[model samples]
Target: MYKPQLNMESLERCVKSLEENENNVRDEAQKALLNICRNVLRSPNDDKTREVRLDDEVVVEKLLPAIGAMECLFDVGYVEDGERLFLPGNVSLSRLQSLSKLLSAVSESKPVTKDIEENSTAQKAFFKKISKDFHNVMHYEDPDLQKKARSVIPIAQLEIAAMTKMRHLQKSYKFSDARKTTSSTQFETELTAKDLLLVELLHWFKHEFFEWVNSPKCSRCSTECVYESVVPSTNHRCSRIELHRCEKCNIIVEFPRYSHPEPLLTLRRGRCGEWANVFTLLCRSLGYDARFIYDETDHVWTEIWSASSKKWIHLDPCENVIDKPLMYEKGWKKKLTYVIAYSKDEVQDVTWRYTQDQEAIMKRRKICTEESLIQFLRSLTDQRQNSSNYSSARKNYVIMRSLLELADMLYIPNLQNKNSNEIYEGRTSGSLAWRLARGEIVQADIEKNYIWDVSKYGKMFELRYNIVKDIYHVVHNDGTILEQKSGWQEGTNITNGGIFRKVENDWKMVYLTRSPQAQYGCIKWIFEIANSELYLETFKLRTKSEVFHGARVSWKIEAIFSDDKVIVIPVSNCNNFYTEDVRKAVKLNIIVTLSGGQGQTAWQHAQVFRQSLENIEEASMIINIQLKNH
Candidate 1:
């Protein structure tokens, strides 16, 4: 349970110390730790690996002196010990991932780099003029991007193995009834079957198909490795190769960091770059009009045109997130400069969709003037559109969509307790230290307690007070048992010996009984209005029983609108009926409280009348209401 933090500085020191050793002690230690990590990863459910004897020869000789290796082992849930290191429970998948990251860190030679490539002739020339850093933003303009994307379609389509995986992704959730609303945005049209497929694809790609490589395993010894240097690659598809030395065997291993998705289909590894590349290609293979989205702050993702929403929707295969445009800026605290999206037929500067801090982003855009950048984007877009042969009507629709998106970007809303997509936390896929190094960690605020949050129906209620714990019963005047408890708590049943007493002539009675120890008991019921134009004509409350022993009854009615506005009406000892016109009520709350009551509180039937604006048809709004005593 007590997991120690992996200290990279200590690990670096240990690596250096081991390298300076006169014998093969360092190799033996590195091999021992690597074996432990590999075994746990390979068969996490094996009970044999749940504990390690601290007195074992290898642990005492090879691991104890290797402080860094021991630290990593402790970090990955091997710290529990009573003279023996014992894993407390089933190995956590996250802890296993953390172990992999630790193995990569000591062997890594350089920081993680972006997968960069020149897009077009103009883009290549432009990068030559501007700083090389800006090329990440401009690489989306590659005219042959679609051709490259289409290349991988046959891999997933023609191959029986790949098709089996794709078929697995198509199996949808049984309860997947499509809705027009998401957490953040509501669409004009309901989600189509295609949208659901894309959602399923994201899940399958992240969990099943892809594996993130922090550091490639050594081909010779399959143990820990150290990065040596870059070398020439014989393959034309791969532009460069990285060499890593097996810490155990001292054999050189070649890692060809390929950007091409074709080979990536077989390799199925790398960081965010490979993820986005293969995922985008897969999207194209599936006939979804997908875009390769490039973030100037060194991230890559995908976007697809949604036929239902009639706009581009953001999808991050690496994070398994969809339509969370603000994740990079708000969640990851990334200082974004330019977020450009490129598809076969178009290229656009979509940075506005991702961040609200345009002023700061513009200030950071120092590699090229804003005007020149705009000109370059426009020139590239124009070239694509002119060649694509889009009709006049199609062009107008595209322009209109862009304007709508721009307007949406400029419009700021009061997000407090409103925005459904609460992307206020950091990245989830990477290791803790890796996330920390990337400045992607965000401290979360205190969690909130919600009374009701059925966001799918666009309804939510915030309760400030903890409800009274006592239970109560609602019965008819003749004691025919309108409603009663069903064994939720001990002694919840009402007194069974007596029937309700008859009320005054021509008046029926409904009563509520409070718990004996409770000072104040209340019952509240919620009513959902079916139509917007319905209005409450009158609310009548009459006491059937005369007051006795300083007992009192009070009632409150709350009409909550769709905009979260609430109107409250409270009345006490209402011997006479009252008429109040409640209009356009989306939800209605009725609460009746009996305070300082020793006996049951009887009412001569509370009646609520509703009338439609179109037709004056009166109806009782309350039906089958329940009462709970304090």
Candidate 2:
């Protein structure tokens, strides 16, 4: 007999490694020990002869509840990663399975058209009320709210009915060989049956998310390109983009921006691939056992065996609806627009597609349409739109949990430094700017207020000799470095951050910093060589609103060398904070000075500046005195 270690120390090790285990070691240990044979409850498994050993009971008593506890915690979080949810060890699988069965029985007990547990008199009133409610709902101007409300209850009701039918059928089936059931035919068939129930659950979840999204009533951009998927309603400033679509309808959409996903599904490099990965993660996280299969034609889908609905469902997110062919067929209904082929490499793992299975798949497809997936909403509902949010739904709760864990384990220690000016891109703003001691320039002009001046584009100004060329460096979120080097394109421009075709320059640039928060935004540096001299400066503001803010402002005055890059050094005026060309220096402000140089062949320079200093660098530049907040 193996001695069981019941101490927290040993259990803690088990808990940690359970997540780290790739061989399903933790899961096997857990399942083998959890919920010692219970006669009071019925299991989806048909076999009832297995005996629970003493150690098995001990494992359940000691570790089962700990696992089940995760279900109650909607916000399961990673230890430094409060941005995501964490599944605890206390979720009771038995309890969940039981609830699923019960919910299913409710739907199957009496068809919606019929009500009342015992008497016809009660049925009459229930039907009458439902009829009246439906009529009133249609009269409302905003049908969405009522429509969602309508979707929620009916879905729940349908799930209950379907589950009840499934409970009866499941009693006759044996799943003892689940892990070892390698027969693709049998495994595929069973997998479909399980997915039916999972899809039913997703329907209600979809409706619930919309309730949260719409409750705040804010203006949303439904343009083909923009996505507004914020949650909790009132946090408007925090709203972010959910997904990005290219200009082609045929183009595939990418969500969450992860590397390509294959071996699970053969989706191409775009939207189809994204949807497959998102749906697969969500389904498994929700406790719905599913398998991803790809067809030779590259189609992917899942089958859910819903013991509650007494059927297996086919779910195809790409179709934007549930594929309910068999169930509708059983009812003698013709093929509706919602049905489609669900194949994995030109094969479907099912011997039969029952009515319950058909209905469950169709329902889930409707709920999990791309428009309603957590991947879409969470990707949008964050300050960065980087998939940082807590989804209350069952699927998202676990997926979020796993992501939180993965993020924590994979996070690089110096990650923030890598994102020095990354937030400007996170904002997905049309414009980007860089500010530094050199000067300011615009690679792409985004200010509608000054779009008319094509002159500001190609103007190149010479500030020093060593600042040879106008080029800068940028770092992406993935830690890749990008060098931004631009010059006068084919089109004729006066040249640089100055004016084109204009005889004189009209702006000056200065470097300024106010607070730590302000330091996080985008800043670009640009260098220009015009009239045999090199001009160095920065263009580092994502928007025009940040052009002027109080802080320290400085001009570059280092000695210029004939054949070297311009050495940049800060120069302060007697007033302690003033620019040579500036008349009035405002506190908490940023300035780019305009300088005109005489030359029939005039030139200008600019760049985007992004710098993240370490603690040592910060300490060296720290000012003792605290300044008033701007």
- How does model 2 fare in lDDT? 0.28
Candidate 1 residue 563 Cα shift, in angstroms, is 47
- Candidate 1 weakest lDDT stretch, 10 residues: 497-506
Computed on alpha carbons, the lDDT of every model, listed in order, comes to 0.53, 0.28
Q: For residues 1-630, what per-residue lDDT tens digits would candidate 2 score against the true structure?
A: 011222222222223323333334434443433332232134433323222221122322332223322221111110100111211223233433333333233335522122112223323332343233222222222334334334323445655755765664454344545446455455446544345555554454333321111011112322233121211223322112223332323232322322222212222223333444435444544445443433211234455435443333465454333544232223222222122222111112131232223443342222123332334324323312232343346345445533543453244224433533431211111111111110111223222121111112233211110112222223333434332323212111112232221111012122222211122222222322222221222221221111222222233322233454334334333123322321111111122233322221111221212112121121111001111111
| Candidate 1 clashes between residue pairs 3 or more apart in a chain or in different chains | 471-629, 472-629
Q: What is the C-alpha RMSD of each candidate to the true structure, in Å?
A: 22.5, 27.1
The total number of steric clashes, by the backbone 3 Å criterion, in model 2 comes to 102
Q: Taking the tens digit of each residue's C-alpha lDDT, what string does model 1 give over 386-478?
A: 654567676676678667666656553333225746756678665433353344653222222212211212222111110022222333434
Per candidate, the number of residue pairs that clash is: 2, 102
